[model samples]
Structure formats: structure tokens, C-alpha cells
Target: MEQLIKELESRARTLRYRIVKMIGPEEKGHLGGSCSIADVVTALYFHKMRHDPKQPKLRTRDRFLLSKGHAALVQYAALAECGYFPLSELDTLKELGSRLQGHPDMMKLPGVEANTGSLGQGLSIASGMAAALKLDGLDSKVYCVVGDGEMAEGQIWEAAMAASFYKLDNLVAILDRNGLQATGRIQERFNTNPVREKWESFGWHVLEIDGHDFAQIIEALDTADQVQGKPVMIIANTVKGKGIPFAEGVASFHNGTMTQEQFARACQLLEAEECEGR
Candidate 1:
């Protein structure tokens, strides 16, 4: 278990590094939210989720949907690292004709479960997928990553009700409660406080955790697997732009570009942290 934690921690760092590179210097991207959920994403793709890069459409594989789709860079990085496609394709991110786009497109990417980025809808889609998998008598689980900011949408609550009403135990939604959204703090923008109570009231099983902690993340996922009659919601408290010192908890970097010097510094900091972990 200790070695597994170390490996997952390293993968999270690598995912953050790739995210920084994908945005690059002076290239606008969803750096903050992407980095915020890097640990959860790493735990999913590299540790918890059952998937296959060689056979992405395998019926038995678990499904992951990034509800906060602007953070598609993290998922893209994972897919590339998992060998779903060539790693070099990452450089073409957001380029015209590239499979990688600002938002996830299932038609373009092999491992992406849905075309997301229109916040609040991915959860609904995941609920539907979970229902279908259940009907098919498949044990495959559906995992969705949602943003606290996106919780303002009525559709999300509706999906929550439906998933619980149907007892979609095979579904798990991880809420990236980073507090900040694209413009500013979520409470200042559209407060979604008391998140845990809200989900619990909706009949979903809830687990709260520090999003960046690998041990808690893995343990929560394992717990979700054991839940029986209700869908699980893991409310992960995280800092926006978690890894980069200057950007952490800063809203401006939500979808902002970095200067050349900032980019170099970001890389340096990430490298130093990675080395220290080893």
C-alpha cells in the first residue's frame, strides 16, 4: 500500500507537469481546475478505475466522465500516459483538427466516455450510463468528476435525485470543491456550501476528503465500491491550481495564460517537488 501511494503521488505530479506543458507559456487553458483535480484523476486512471488503453471500449471497463470539462487537459494527459494514444499528440491540444479540444469530445478521443464541458450535464449522462450498465447486469461503475461551481445548475440536482431514486450504487461522483471557479471564489460567485449535507439529503452516500491526499482518495474509492443501494458522492476539498505555488487558490489562473518566466518557474517547482518525493 505504501508503494502504491508513492506511485500514485508520482503520477499525479506527472499529470500536473503535462497539464502545465499543454497550456504552455502565453497559451490560455483551464490550468487551475485541471491541476486541482490531478490527484483524483491520477488515482482513477492509474490506480482505482478498471480500464484498458488497448481496448478502450471493453464492456467490462469502468467509465469516467469529467463533468467540469474545461479541465479536460488532466483527462487528456491521463489518456495519453495510459497509452490510449501517442503522447506526442498532446502538443496539438486545442489546435484545429486535433483530437484534443478545449472540451472533451467522445467522438474524437477513444477513452473519453462523453463529450463534456457544458457543465451540469455530465452527471446526468453518467447516471444514465450507470443505469444502462446495471440493466445489462454489468458490474462496471460510472465515475463522474463535478465542480462545486457547476452545482448551481438545476440539472445536477435532478440527476442526483434520479440516481438515488433508482439506487445507482455503481455510480460515484467526485466533487472538486476547490472553492474557486473561473472568475472568483465559488461562495462569492454562487455559493454551494454545505455540500456534504445537500448530497446526503438527496439520498446519496457522501464521503468528504482532502482531494490531494492519495491515501484518503484510494480509501474513499474502495469505500464507494462497497456502498449498496445509493450512489456515492465524494466531496473532495481542494485548492485551485494546487501544485503551482503562485497560482494555488488564485482564481485568475482558472483559465489564464502564464508568462514565459512564470512557465519556467512552474516547471522548476514541479520538478523540485517530484525529486523531493523520490
Candidate 2:
């Protein structure tokens, strides 16, 4: 476990640096939401999730659904780090004919379970998977990462209720509460202030923490597993462009192009963490 944590931290830093490098010239992709959840996704792909990069379709493996598909870059980063494919494939993201589409395509990408970009439906899919695993007597877990903005969709609640009804303890939902949508802040857009209370009311084991902290990510994931009878939700508080200087805590950078200057500055910041786990 200790060695795995060290490796995951290194891969996370490497991913951040590479994401900064991959932005701008290589399509200047969705840096905001991607950077926001890099740590969480890194921890999952590297340490927690039981997935095989070599044989992605292995039936008994755990599943992860990125319901907030805007952050495909984060998945791409983690995928490359975990050896799903060569790191070279990430530059083809969002390009025409590229397997790495703007969102996940399970058929194309190794280890991806859901081809999700649409909001609110991923939780339902994950719930179904969780129930199916239980029915089949499989011990696999299902994890779905959804944005706080996506919580506005009613389907999420329906899925939540269904999961609780079946006592799907194998399912876990994570809400990336960076709090910004395409237009503005989530509060101004839809107002999901009492998020934990809402989830708890619907019958979920909920935990909140700073999403960027590695230790918090580890502890939350562990606790989510030890929990009994109900599914779990980890509400991760994060900055939009977490490691970037100007972009950090700002929403404008959420889905915009990164100028050479901006990209350069971002790379420099990520470089400081290069020797993080050395």
C-alpha cells in the first residue's frame, strides 16, 4: 500500500505536468474540470480501482463512470498513467477519428465502463451495474464521478433512491463540488447548497473533504468501503484549475483555450511537484 501510494503520487504529478503540456498546442482541452479532480481520479485509477489495463473487459473488475464527462482529460491522464495505452494517444483527444473523444468511449478506451458525457444518467448506469454485480454474486464495486452541476438533473435522485432501495452497498458516488458551470457559479445557476444533507436524506453514506489532499482521498475511499448497508458519496471540494496560478479558483479557464504564456506558467507550477514522491 505504501509503495502504491508513492507510485500514485508520482503518476499524479506526471499527469498534471503532461496535462499542462498537452493543453494549448495539442487542442487546449478542458483544463478546468480536468485539473480540479486530477488527484481524486489519480488515486482511484492508480490505487483504489481494480482494473486491468491489459484486459479491460475482464468481467469481475471494478467499474468507474465519469458522469461529469467534461473532465475527460483527467481520465485520459490517469489512463495513460495506468498503462491503458501509450501516453502518445492523449494528444489525439477530441480530434476527429481519435479514439480518445471529448468524452469516454468504453468500446474504444481500455478500462472505461461507461461512454458518458451526458449529465445525470451515469449514476443510474452505475446503480444498475452495482445491483447486477450483487445479483451475480460478484464482489466488484461501481464508482461514479458526477459534477455538482450535474446534480441538477432529476435522474440522479431517481438513481440514488433505487440504489438505496436495493441496498447496493457496492456503489459509490463522488461529487466534484468545484461549484462552477459553463455560465457561472453553481449556486447562482442551480443552488445545491445542502448537498450532503440531500444525499443523506436519500439514504447514502456521505463524506466531505478537500479533494486535492492525497491523504484525504485515501481516507475517504477507505471509509467509503468500510461503510455498511448504504452506498457512499464523497463530496470533494476543489479549485477549478487546481494547480495553475491564474486559473486556480477561476471559472473562465473552465473550458477555454490556453495561450502559450498561460500554458507555460502552468507547466512551471506543476514542475515544482516533479520530485514530490522521490
Index of the highest-lDDT prediction: 1
List, residue by residue over 1-278, the lDDT tens digit for candidate 1.
99999998888888899999999999898999999999999999999999999999999999999999999999999999999999999999999999998999999999999999998999999999999999999999999999999999899999999999999999999999999978898888879888989999999999999999999999999999999999999999999999988889999999988999999999998888889888
Candidate 1 clashing pairs, residues 3+ apart or interchain: none
Which regions of candidate 2 deviate over 4 angstroms?
1-7, 25-28
lDDT of 2 by residue, 27-109 (tens): 45677888888889988887888888898888889888898887888888888877889999877776789888878888887
As a whole number from 0 to 100, the lDDT of residue 236 in candidate 1 is 95
- Model 2 / residue 22 / CA error / Å: 2.8
> What is the TM-score (0 to 1) of candidate 1?
0.98
